[model samples]
Target: MNHASAFDMDAFRPHDHGRCRRAARAAAERECQARGLRLTPARAFVLDALLESHRAMTAYELLDRLREAGLGKQPPIVYRALDFLVANGFAHRVERLGAFVGCVHGADDHRAAFLVCRSCRQVAEAVLEAPPAALTAQAEATGFAVERVTVEAEGLCERCRADA
Candidate 1:
């Protein structure tokens, strides 16, 4: 399986998961309405599955859940749902893990950093107010325009560390 970097691992951990999930879904619904986007059944189900757990889920894993829920057992169904969620900013793709996670923040494609637990593969996201001045300056000096940045840190979570 793909692994996030050590820095990304710091973000994912136990917390008020229930509240987080509910809040994320509510925010997504509102954002969809505001943008004239429909939170269709498949998309909603995919988002709910992601929100229900902190762990990043692979497309296949999500398909299993969709199958159990009688949404659709086919791969295309889950893939299409995931694509819509990610495209709309309601979810994010964890490139390192090749999995998906529900965005805790609303549908804004701001610069986000991630902490991922290697053991459990849970992810937590944080928004960067601005790019580091040093990095920005360096890019400017090189006549390069900084467009996007993805910072991922990976490590063992407290529970995993404790178990070790």
Candidate 2:
């Protein structure tokens, strides 16, 4: 997976998950409205499914859900929706797993860092105020223009650790 290190397991800690999902959905809706973006059926459904859990979900997994829901069986439908969501900051890709997660923080300025659960594969996003120092220095030294960056950490979550 694309990762720099491991992290604390605060994401797997208990809270009102249903409430969190609702809040996330509401935020997405608000952001879409503000930006004049379309929260299309396919895109909204995909976001809802991802937000149902903190886990990163593969395209195949999500495609199955879409098929069962009769949204669309074609891969392009989901792929296109994913493209829009990721481009608009409504969703993010967890490159390590080649999966996607709904962005709960709405469209914000912070860069996303993640604590990834290796067992369950649930990801909790952390906002970084700036790029990591090493990457910044490297880019500057090379005169390379950095457009985007994703920082991820992998390890077990509390539940997985307990299970072990």
Q: What does the lDDT read for residue 117 in candidate 1?
A: 79
Model 1, runs deviating above 4 Å: 1-13
Tens digit per residue, CA lDDT, model 1, 1-164: 12221233333555677887898899999988888988889899999999987789999999998889998889999888888888888898888899999987776655566777788888877766666677778999999999876666778778879888
Computed on alpha carbons, the lDDT of every model, listed in order, comes to 0.80, 0.82
TM-score of each: 0.83, 0.88
Q: Specify the poorest-scoring 10-residue window by lDDT in model 1.
A: 1-10
Candidate 2 Cα misplacement greater than 4 A, ranges: 1-10
* Per-residue lDDT value at 104 in model 1: 78
Each prediction's total of clashing residue pairs, residues at least 3 apart in sequence or on different chains, is: 13, 1
